[model samples]
Target: MKVTLERNHLLKSLSHVHRVVERRNTYPILANVLFKASDDHVELRATDLDIEVTESVPAMVSTPGATTVPAHTLYEIVRKLSDGAEVRLETDGGENMVLTSGRSRFNLACLNPDSFPDLKSGAFAHEFDIAAASLRELIERTQFAISNEETRYYLNGIYFHAVQNSASGSLFRAVATDGHRMARAEIAAPAGAEGMGGIIVPKKTVGEVQKLLDGVDGDVHVEVSDTKIRVTVGPVVLLSKLIEGTFPDYDRVTPKNNDKQMLVDKAGFAIAVDRVSTIASDRGGKAVKLSASNGLLELSVTNPDHGTASEEVAVDFETDGFEIGFNARYLLDIITQIRTESAVFLFNDANSPTLVKEEGSEANALYVLMPMRV
Candidate 1:
């Protein structure tokens, strides 16, 4: 195989796909990115058996063929070369790939591209397109709530599925929880996104995909099935296996009507909580208390090991007074996800969950945080 590619183009495409490459694989090819030349384009792909990513970049192809070279090695080689440097790749049989740019040259041991595992790109039965802005909002609104505990793997990813409500009719929703708190965000259900099962997209894949889509310029194509899910944005495609388990019934955990409500500026409340939490202990048993009455709300933290801190913020409220304690970190997390300038909070009492909603949107996004006994 012989191909010539511009340094920056190859680097950008490799950067997108390399995140899915398996770093520690006994099978050497698994650690490599497949470079294939076909139909006047060079294709790059990487996978960790569970997830795969593919991208195409422009290149001048002399002999159309394919080879596998260490993904990290190739990425490093291309990155270190001067910008705009032309990269030339050549393989003598399936041995090693010769890489050269200017005075820099390196040889990467190659594995037969034919041995690379065939990963599904999902001819997925169901597909839909959602605006990039909407998809970005959905990911940001709930990603902070996904659990990191592997033993409870089903909770490790943002849950995507279809749902219906009297207020919204039908919807595309994303929900995540880490036991202590939950975030639920929704967008209008798009055409062609029907009859699909829920899936848990793992944490690593989500983080990488978020970066890729963060600055993208167009709509993203979403495809899902029983075992695999794929999202295609522009020239890149990300395919990940669905977590093989059922997510916990999240609806039951959301508070129906918490009886007490308070409306305040999102920024003001979040800043007060953050300042108060500076002295709050982060240990499991520690908490920051919210005391609400009339139109005054006080956020205070008691840290016996350190000192006590408090802040009083005025909020618009008329419900019965209540005091609730919550893990300070979790509270900040839910608050930061709000997109609006104002926020609403609902509480039943010290012993029940507190509900929070961002203000001024018709969206059904809501957050639930269980009170901590302090």
Candidate 2:
């Protein structure tokens, strides 16, 4: 197999696909990327059993063939090569693959392409195209709440589904929770997605999809099935297995009658919480107390081993004063998702979950954070 590719083009394709190759693999072939060259194009594919990524780049093909090579090693070599250098990869039915660029040459061990695992492409039950920006927004707003606990594998990913409401006929919703906090975001459902069922998109897949959407502007093709999901962005394709467990009914956890409203600057509130959290006791708990009255909100944290810290911020509060305690880290995570300058917080009492939203936005995104005893 022989192919000549530009340094930048090869580097970009390698960077996109090689991330799926595990650094340490139980099987040697799993650590390598399968390279297939034919008809003026080179396809790079990598997988770790559950997730697979493939990227195709235009290349000058000399002898059309296929082989596998260590993904990380090849990526590193191409990354360090001179900019604009023409990269040539050649393997003559030998155990070693020769990589040549300018005066630099490296011989890398090659693995049998026949031994590489095939990524199964089954017929998808649902397929649609969504704006990359909208899809990216849904992921960023909810992914932080996905649980990392292995025991509750159901909570390890974002629950994506379609819902119907009086306000919005059809909506695409993404919900995630780690038991302490929950985030839900909704967008207008794309055509052809109304019949789709709920699926748990694993955290790794969400991360890889987010990476593919960065600085990318176009419609992304999405395909979903009972056990797998596939996303296509231009020349790259990402396929991942859906988590098997069922996600809990998240609507039951959201507060319904929280009427007390407090609106504050998102940046200012986040900064105040962060500053006061410094004095929170790591031994006892990292909780910060929020005391809100008419037009002011005070944040304070106390630690037996350390001194107490307090900060006051101006806010728009109408209801009577109330105090609530929450994990400082959770509050920061929720606040970061608010894109607008103003963040709206709804409270029932100090003991119940608080509802948070961005003010003056038609986007139906909400965050629920359970209170902690400070």
Candidate 3:
């Protein structure tokens, strides 16, 4: 393969697919990216058995062929080269790949394209269009709450499902939970994505999709079967295997009616929780106490080994006094996502789940944080 691509153009496109390259590989080909040149486009692909990412960028193709080049090596070379320096890449006799820019030259070991594992692209049972921005928003708002514990493999991914909102018809939603905290975000279902089943997309796949969605515009062709799922966003396609386990009954866990409510500034709330956590014990969890009543909101943390910290912030509240304890990190995870003037919190009592919502985007996004026993 012989192609000349602009440095920035090549980097941006390669960045989308390179994440699939295994950091530690048993096979050399698995560590390389499959580079194919045809017509006026250069395609790059990498996989780690479970996930595959492919991307294409416009380039000047002189000879149409394909080869596998060390992914990280090529990326490092291009990244170190001077900006805007056009990069020329070619393979000689399928033995090695050569990269040249100005006076710099680097020869990288290459493997024939036939040695690369199979990567498939096909018709999706449900092909739909979603604004790159919209999908990114949905993923970002809920991904943090996904469970990282491997023992409970089922909670390791966000659950994508079709949900009906009493206020606004049917919506496509992404929900995640770590048993203690939960996050949910919804968007209007696109025209073609109807009657789709809930699928659990592993965390790695979510990160890959988020990386590629930057500044991208267009519809992603999304298809899901019982075993595998594929998303083609523009010139990039990400294929991943679905988690086989079933997600928990999330609906039952959602609090029904928590009459006590408090609306506080999001930034102030996060900052207060952060400061109070500093004095709390570093082990177990960073627990903080929240006291809400009248128009006052107080945050306090006491460390048996260290000292105590507390802060008071003005908030809109009208209910019986409530003191609740929660992990500071979990609070920050859900609070940082609130992009509103005031973050709304509803509670039942000390040992109940607290519902958090943003004033303008309350229904669009919601969080359930189970309080810690103090």
Candidate 4:
């Protein structure tokens, strides 16, 4: 296989696809990227069994053929080449592939392309196109809450499904939770997304999709099946397997009747929480205590080994008085996603989950955080 392409173009394609290949692989071929040079483009593909990514870039093919080379090694070689320089890859059906750019040359061992595994997408039951802006919001708001615990594997990805919203037609929702906190975001359902079965997009796949969405505008094509999902963003395509376990009914834990409301400046609240959390003992816990009453909210953290720290911020709290404990790291994660100036917090005493959302905005997104005993 022989192909010539601009260094910038080849580097961009390699960066997009090489991330799918894990650093250490039990199978040697799994650590390599498959390259197929044809007509007017070169197709690069990399997979780690659970996820696959493919991208095609314009190139001049001298001898159309296919081969495999270590993904990271090739990426590093091209990345160091001078920008705007031309990259030439040639393999004469041999064990070594020669990479040439300017005065730099490297011979990389090649693997049999026939041995590479294919992740069959099967037949998709649902396909849709969603605006890039809407998709970005759904992912950025909820991805932080995806659980990393492997035992409850269903919570490892964002749950996506469509539901009827009589007032606004149909809405597509993305939800993620790690038992202690939950985040949910919704957007108007795109055409063909209605009636689709809920799918759990794995965390790694969500991250890769987010990266691919960068600088991308317009709409992204999405295909979903019972067991797999395919997302096409520009010249890149990402296919991933869906988690098999069922996600818990999130509505049950979403508080709807919290009577007390507190409105605080988002920036002030986040800063105060972070400052007080600095004193929290790393070995003990990262809990911050919130005491609200009489139009003021006091944040404090106590550590037996390091004493205590406290700060106060004015808020619009009508509640008589209440104190609650929450993980400072979790609170900051939710706060970062709030796009409004004010953050609205609804409380039902100090023991129940607290509901959080942007003040004076339509509820397109919401967060729930369970309280901890300080």
* Candidate achieving the largest lDDT: 4
Error (Å) of candidate 1 at residue 359 is 2.1
Expressed as tens digits, the lDDT of each residue in 1-374 for candidate 3 is 78999999888776776778878999888999888899999988889988998888899999999998888878888888888999999887658888989999998888878989975645556667788888999999999999999999999999997776688777898999999999999899887666778889999999888887877887677777766789888778889888888999998999988888788998988898988888888674788988876688889988888888999988988864778999999999999999887899988888889999889643589999999866
Summing lDDT over every window of 10 consecutive residues in candidate 1, give the lowest-scoring window. 192-201
* Pairwise TM-score winner, candidates 1 and 3: 1
Model 1, span 1-374: residue lDDT tens: 89899999999999998877766887777998998997778999999888889999999999999999889878887888998999999887869889988888888898889999878564677899988888888889899999989899989888888876678667888898999999998888888764456778887777877988888767899888878888898999888887788999988878886877789888999899989888877673558888877788898888888989999899988864667898888888988887788888888878888899977667468999999987
- Once fitted onto the true fold, the runs of candidate 1 whose alpha carbons sit more than 4 angstroms away are 121-123, 284-286, 319-321
Q: Give the winner by lDDT: 1 or 4.
A: 4
- Model 1, residue 181: distance off in Å is 0.7
> Model 2 over residues 1-374: C-alpha lDDT tens digits?
99999999999999999988888999999999999999989999999999999989999999999999999999999999999999999999878899999999999999999999987978899999999999999999999999999999999999999998787799999999999999999999999799688999999999999999999997999999999999999999999999998889999989999998888999999999999898787775699998877688999998988889999999989865689999999999999999889999999999999999989858479999999998
Ranking by lDDT: 4, 2, 3, 1
Residue 280 miss distance in model 4 (angstroms): 0.5
Q: Candidate 1: deviation at residue 121, Å?
A: 4.7
lDDT comparing candidate 3 with the true structure: 0.86
**lDDT of the candidates, in the order given:** 0.85, 0.93, 0.86, 0.94
Question: How far in Å is the alpha carbon of 45 misplaced in model 1?
Answer: 0.8
TM-score of every candidate relative to the true structure: 0.95, 0.98, 0.94, 0.99
Among all windows of 10 consecutive residues in model 4, the one with the lowest summed lDDT is: 278-287
Q: What are the clashing pairs of model 2?
A: none
lDDT of 2 at 178: 93
Predicted structure 1: lDDT: 0.85
Ranking by TM-score: 4, 2, 1, 3
Those runs of model 4 whose alpha carbons end farther than 4 Å from true positions after fitting are none
